[model samples]
Target: MITGEIKSQIDRIWDVIWSGGMSNPLEVVEQLTYLLFIKRLDDQQTTALERATLLDEPLVDNPFRLGKDELGRDYDDLRWSRLKNMHPEEAFDVVANRVFPYIREMRGDESTYAQHMKDARLTIPSASLLSRVIDLLDAVPMDNLDTKGDVYEYLLSEISSAGKNGQFRTPRHIIQLMVEMLAPEPGDTIVDPASGTCGFLVAATEYMRAHHADAINSGKWREHFHRQMFHGFDFDNTMLRIGSMNMLLHGVEQPDVRYRDSLAESNTGDADAYSMVLANPPFAGSLDYENTAKDLQRIVKTKKTELLFVALFLRLLKPGGRAAVIVPDGVLFGSSKAHKELRRTLVEDHKLDAVVKLPSGVFKPYAGVSTAILFFTKTNSGGTEKVWFYEVTADGMSLDDKRTPLLSDEKLGALAVLTDEEHGKNNLPDVLKRWQSRNSTEKDRERTDQSFCAPKADIAAQDYDLSLNRYKEIVHEEIEHRSPTEILDELDQLEKEIADGMAELRAMLLGGAE
Candidate 1:
């Protein structure tokens, strides 16, 4: 967790940028990301030097070179530590003229971060503003991996309130829950088709490191972790840049974070390749059939982005590959042919593991679309016996725009020790617990429970409708009412009591008068 002091420091930097004429929040974050990237490069070079000294070996690869570039400017001046100490105007000139060009020309091993720096421009407007921002950034503690990740996440969360292109940052806790449920292994190939800042991929990496540390330390697993384990696709260059930086900061050395429209015909490669996928794809939009991928259309003939993404997932996953993806509630029981067909394909053809219905406000202050997480495995043949359905009412947060945390730190993650009452307020912990035992204990739970298993045959009978409400039996409380004669008797008794009281009052008044 980032301390309050760190968040305040970040906010101060943001204020300086805002007052410096970069009013767009996304632009502000992008510019800040560039500076941070430069700082991180210096830090990496310093660490390399330290390691070389300790081992008494020559440094094979230093991110910085101590020489002049073709423009005859000293490359050493572009280093963050050197630039930070220079006068504001000289520092700005070096960053604008030298550093930006140097980063743009960086190739091969540095291509992941360099690729996005091609169009990098310094728009801070004034030398003093740039200097102030750089100095504040210098004060932030990025030595600890957790602190750096948390600080970047805090910066990303700012974009959520801005609301650009239906993109909202998935709550960190929600991402953690999905990653925990998936339980990605060391060598598992994971992909997020709509990778926004690559939160899903980062969370998966963290989970693996936390649980399978020994496996990650092995040579084979280490090779996979550094290069081949994670893949993400996004069409927006800004998102690509941010996502790639996010991976690098989280210790993923060479994640495939690149630009590709996942739903377009151009995305033909990587079909049936990955072992796991975790995503919260955009929905409620339409696309032209001519532009939609032909392969996805063959699976589900529709232009609705929501349905297309489902088809895209099916096309992307290798046989026996598992996925946990978020979809709008309409995909669950829509009457359209494409909707019904996709749901049927999952239940009849693949292993539809579970459908976790989320609260509508989960995406709030941006959208209130009711959504559900679909857990399934690609079998290319029938494997679904019983589908687990869980209705998540609260996810350790209030179901409102504020989204206040409802649980204490002790009951936060997968290993959360929550009592029944706590589980009632936030059902995520229970959802995971029940999902792990879906085939055993969950199979016998009644339809009236919060989570229960609905047999495949029952689902087929309903035309493969996967909505929890379709099979969930509501246990209406039985009400007892008095009969008409009993009601009349009660009325008569009340009338008699009223008459007796009236007579006693009259008698008392008459006796007093006599």
Candidate 2:
């Protein structure tokens, strides 16, 4: 967790940047990404230097050397460590003129973060503001993985709360809930096609580090975790930079985060490549069929971005590879042939694991559209026996524009430790627990409960409509009905009282007139 003081510092920097004429939140984050990445690189090199000296070994590489560049500034001055100690004007000059340009060349031709950084430009307006930000950022420690990653994550959350760029961020708690449900293994190769900010991929790295620490600690798995495990695609250049920085801060050395228009890009070379996919693609929108990928169209012909993304997932996943993705509610029960065919494919050809309904307010302040998480495995032959269903009412936060937390921080998210009473405020913890037991106890649960299973045959009977209400049995409150005789008697009494009151009123009026 990032401390309150750290959050304040970040917010202050953001306000400074916002007032500095960098109005776009995404642009602010991108600018911040450049500086943070530079700082992180210097910090890593410093750690390596200390370790090597302590072990009496030669330095592997020196990112900076004492030499003058063509611009006549010492190469060392471009580093965060050196720039932090310089005068404000000097620091600003170095950052704007040299440091920003130098970062693109830090990593070789093949580095994703570097590839994204090729377009880096310093948008911080003034010397004093940049200095103030550096001073404030310097105060916050970024030594440990958690603190460093949390710092960036907090900044992203602020961007979300700031409104314009909230569309780029998924609520971290919701991301955590989805990650906990998937429980990514160390060996899993995960991808998020519409990878804005790469929240799912970052959460998966955290999950692997937490649950499969032993396997990941091994050199082979560590290499895989760093290089091959996490992949993300996005067409927006700003998002690619932000997502790369996000993964890098989270300790993923080299994630496959690059530019790709997921829906439009052909997947012929990468078909059936990934073992896991997790995403929350754009919702309730359509794309032009002319630009849509032919292969995705072959899966299920649709222009809806939501349905096309699902088809993209199906195309990308290797046989038996699993996925957990968010789709709008329309995809759940839409009567269109494309929607029905995709649902049928999941039920008839592949294994549809579960459908978890998220609250409409989950994406609020940006979108209030209802959405649900679809968990399924790609199998050529049908294997879906019964699909688990969960109705998530409260996600520990209010279902409103503000999305205020209803409970303390500890009582939130899927891994939250909450009492039974607290569970009502946050269903994610219960959702995770029930999901773990989905094959066993979850199947036998009654339809009226919050979560249960629907047999494959039953789903087929409903034309593959996967809406929760289609299978969910509402336990309406029982009310006692009045007998017909009693009702008529009450009506007669009312009529007699009306007549008596009217007669009394008429007599009083007549006496007054007389």
Q: What is the TM-score of candidate 2?
A: 0.86
TM-score of each predicted structure versus truth: 0.86, 0.86
Clashing residue pair totals per candidate (backbone < 3 A):
0, 0
Query: How would you encode candidate 2's per-residue C-alpha lDDT over 407-436 as one tens digit per residue?
Result: 877777789889888988999989999999
Worst window of 10 by summed lDDT in candidate 2: 160-169
Per-residue lDDT for 450-514 in model 1, tens only? 99999999999999999899999998899999999999999999999999999999999999999
- Candidate 2 clashes between residue pairs 3 or more apart in a chain or in different chains: none
Instruction: Quote the positional error of residue 48 for candidate 1 in Å.
Output: 5.7
Instruction: List candidate 2 segments past 4 Å from native.
Output: 1-15, 39-85, 136-167, 265-267, 494-514
Which ten-residue region of model 1 has the weakest summed lDDT?
144-153
